[model samples]
Target: MAATIIDVARRAGLSTATVSRALRGLPNVSESARARVQQAAEELSYTVSPIASQLSSGRTGAVGVVLPFVNRWFFGQVVSGIDSVLRANDMDLLLYNLGDTRVHERFFERMPVRRRVDALIVLTLPLSEDETRALSSLAVPVAVLGEPTPPFWNVRIDNSVAAATAVRHLVNLGHRRIGLITGAAHDPRRFATPILRRDAYRTALEAAGIRYDPRLEAMGHFGIEEGAAAMAQLLTLPEPPTAVFAESDEMAFGALRTLRRMRLRCPEDVSVIGFDDHETAHLMDLTTIAQPVVEQGALLARLVLKALAGSHEEPSDTVLPTRLVVRGTTGVARRDAAPGVPPSPGAATDNGTGARGARSPVP
Candidate 1:
């Protein structure tokens, strides 16, 4: 039969309560008793029951992560970061993926995570007033990754600034006719990130003294296949754009694929840039606005821990920084390169940095 606390207490020559307190590292147990309990536990291979420990402490020993899409690369990276911190702290993770509308609605209606986790981490999902109230009623620490929800800890990057930097990069490369592939147009949930990015794209164009043409904007809906279709649609325009800025690297990958299928050379024909310097962006030589994806998640987890520990008094917002990563996918626009035609092989490949060398891959 497996060893239990009783066996450990008997072998240690101490009361069961003393053995339990020593094993749990609770105060009031002397060093001698703790050593004896440790030796006895090792000798009998005895371990405390996690269920019993949780019941006694009234803590589930888990953090709940609620996100819209678990399958997306960005979300996966964030979750990995969150899990790393939580795991190191001896805590478990419970994921709630509200990808489907029905599931999202049901989650708020049922409030399943109530009393099931010590804290909650919410990712970029726009919450309604009622839904926000429902989450608040859980009475646990909540940290959000996007916009600041008053009374909740928040961590995020400035979407408007990062997105504007991407469009401005293309404009500085001498591209007048720029296209935008955005996810906001088709999102039923009205996620704040996509909307902010799309608006920034328009504002950047105006700042560059360029007219904002709706025809140059396509609905990518934040998916690879959707991005490809959106790129194809832009190519069908009467006067297609000389460069394209995709709101996500996954969508940028699709745009690159479409360019390849059409036998059009990147930068030489249609320069491309993306947001979120995803892991594969370097492999694809994509220029993008790099946000600290994993670090944001780790920060959110740390904030939740601080709140749970009673160290964090008031709700706080932490906005991480973002930078532009230049790579081979974006370069100086060829003035004579027309739609459906690639520039001459000897055309300048300057990446708008005034340097005339091979573009180095982004790490």
Candidate 2:
């Protein structure tokens, strides 16, 4: 049978509270006492119960991660990084997937994770000012993975910069009428990422002396199907764009599929670019702006763990770098011909970029 905390206390000739404090590395316990408790526990072959230790120390030995969607590729990669860190630290992970708006409302209204986790990590969930204030009032330390809000530790990439870079690539390829396919925003005024990326798209076009054409923009839910549908809408316009930039790799794939369905060749007919250098980007020969998605998740977990370890210092905001990867999808703009020109029968075909949101190798 395993020895309990009482047995260690008795062996070390100390009170149960002192044994608990020393064994758990809580402050106010002298180093000599801590050494004595360690020796006694070793001799008795006693192991501390994580649950009891947490209870006495006012901790839960777990971190809660709340995300808008768990099934998505980006979220999956982030969760993998966070899970790896938690496992090494002997802490458990409690995942709360807010499936939709109703779930988000209910979760925030209750704040069910209160007292259930030692720390919390929120992954790019757009919240209102009221909700943000409510979260700040929670007892546990909070870390966010996108756009840093006040009083919270954050690790994120500049969405606007990434978007601008993607646009610049298409513009440099001599694409005059560039179309944009981006995620739909519920509220454009929430100061969220969709708005930032969209605004950046327009800014980049204007800087290049190109007019921001409303007819050249399409909205999607950031899914492959939605992207394909949106691309179809842009393609049917009287003056279709010479190139298109999708806000995400999945959307880019959809656009590619649409072009293929229409028997139009990429770059030869329409250039396609996307953000997020997904694993399969190389496979599909996609040109995209790559961000450190997995690293962001790992960093968020590290911040939460540091706070849980009695480090009261606030961590500085971290902005990761992004780079544009040129692959097969993007090419020099083709000469203008009659509107809606299809590719020749012998036009070269490239592989489609299927969704492979694997953990990106950190540079």
lDDT of each: 0.88, 0.83
Count clashing residue pairs in model 2. 0
Evaluated at residue 349, the lDDT of candidate 2 is 36
> lDDT per residue, candidate 1, 1-363, as tens digits?
999999999999999999989988899999999999999999998888997898778899999999999999999999999999999899999999998789999999999999899999999988999988988999999999999987789999999999999999998988888999998556678899988999999999999999999999998988899899999999888788889999999899999888777766687778899989998889999999999999999999988998888785888889999999999888777655564344443445554466653422321
| True lDDT of residue 66, candidate 1 | 98
lDDT of 2 by residue, 52-145 (tens): 8788878898999999888788889999989999999989999999877788889989999988988999998877889888888886789988
* Candidate 1 residue-pair clash tally: 0
TM-score (C-alpha) between model 1 and the true structure: 0.89
**Which runs in model 1 stand beyond 4 Å of their true positions?**
8-19, 27-43, 337-363
Q: Let me know the TM-score candidate 2 reaches against the reference structure.
A: 0.84
lDDT of 2: 0.83
